[model samples]
Target: MPRVVKPKDVRRAEVLDRALALFLERGYENVSLNDLLAVSGTSKGAFYHYFPSKEALVVALAQRSAGEAFEVLRPVFDQPGKNALERLNAGLAASYQVKLGMGVPEPIAAMRSLLMPENQALFRKIVTIWEDLFRPVLTEVITQGVREGVFDTFDPEGVGDMIQGFAASIQDYLVRMFDAADAKSRRKTIDDCVKRLKLYGIATDRILGLPDGATVVLERKQVEAMMTLFMPSRPAGSLP
Candidate 1:
């Protein structure tokens, strides 16, 4: 019997799945087109038929991941009969659950890689994509909170932008702390995120499903070790 042929979309997904695994195992910069083709078990011609280039593949991966994340929280924002605070809490929880379920570290590691000077453009693009995807949803939620008297922010849109910026900064800080192998920095980063959230008029109880004054204890050594495995190769003494 002749070998079965996969559909174009199926083949493309297979390539992406393999490439994502390889990129997760090795940093994005370290993974070449040849490496992707080799791991994906697809001919160069077939790979090009889908991705065109490695950068395109990375962009697709980022966009797909962001789209999935947005979809996970979209229902929470759209759900009726829930107040702003409840909806916001549900959105946050849904996001956390999705990340947990994915169980893949490449998305976060890829963001860390984009922070490098060489990948500045890609990083900016990713940030813009995230802002575009999240800002309006956040603005709607904040506006609802303001009308419901649960939140008293004067500028809902500005607050949404700030929240997105704060979240990005926190993610970057966590990656840096992990790269530096500093447990204290990791702890401090979490504390700083909480402080900033409170400053934004987000009630502590409405954040991350954590109670007010809840203590967050992370196993720093283990997490640092895990991050070290994914840390991009850099010159000695260079900041992450």
Candidate 2:
């Protein structure tokens, strides 16, 4: 029989799948183009066809990861009999949960692996991709909230943008928290970050003209859970 050929999309997906496995097993920055070729079983030309550059791979993986994340979150926007407020709450909670679960794990440890100092640029890239991807989802919910009189906003789109900004604001805090030098420093960083999250929750309520404590952007419990889930404390005397 003649050689069977895979469709372009199939081949592209295979490369990405292989890449994701490599990324998860060994952090993204550690995996070189040659490494990808060897593991993905694709030639340099073929890999370049799918990803023009290593950074291109980051973009592709970010898009795919963000897409996967949205799939998990899509249901929250379609729940039966859920009011705008209810959906907003559920949606926010679910989004955090999905992220904490590292569901696609940072649009593909696109978030988790980005934690290392070397992957800072890649981390920033994925964050932008995620914000852009999810902005419309939040806008829709905000618009609906306005329609149902659950949220008070004259410009839901702008509010949606602001929410994305607020969420992105935590990125630096998280980096600092994770990079803390010692147990005491880490504990302080965590506390400060968690407090900032709580404040953001309140700010969200104010933005929507709700009561002082209407929304819970990132609950303390959720923060703690995510911290434990994603970056557990290194064992004493363990390498960083």
Q: Give all TM-scores, in the order shown.
A: 0.66, 0.82
Question: What TM-score does candidate 2 get on C-alpha atoms?
Answer: 0.82
Local error of candidate 1 at residue 152 (angstroms): 5.7
lDDT of 2 by residue, 143-240 (tens): 88888888998988888787778777877766775767776776676688778887887888988989977875776555555555456556423321
Once all C-alphas are superposed, what RMSD does model 1 give against the true structure?
Answer: 7.0
Ten residues in sequence with the least summed lDDT for candidate 1:
213-222
lDDT of 1 by residue, 15-124 (tens): 88888777656666678788998999989998899988998987877777778778877997778999887777677556544533343665556555555555555555
Q: List candidate 1 stretches off by more than 4 Å.
A: 100-127, 145-155, 179-240
Kindly report the root-mean-square deviation of model 2 from the true structure over all alpha carbons: 3.8
Maximum-TM-score candidate:
2
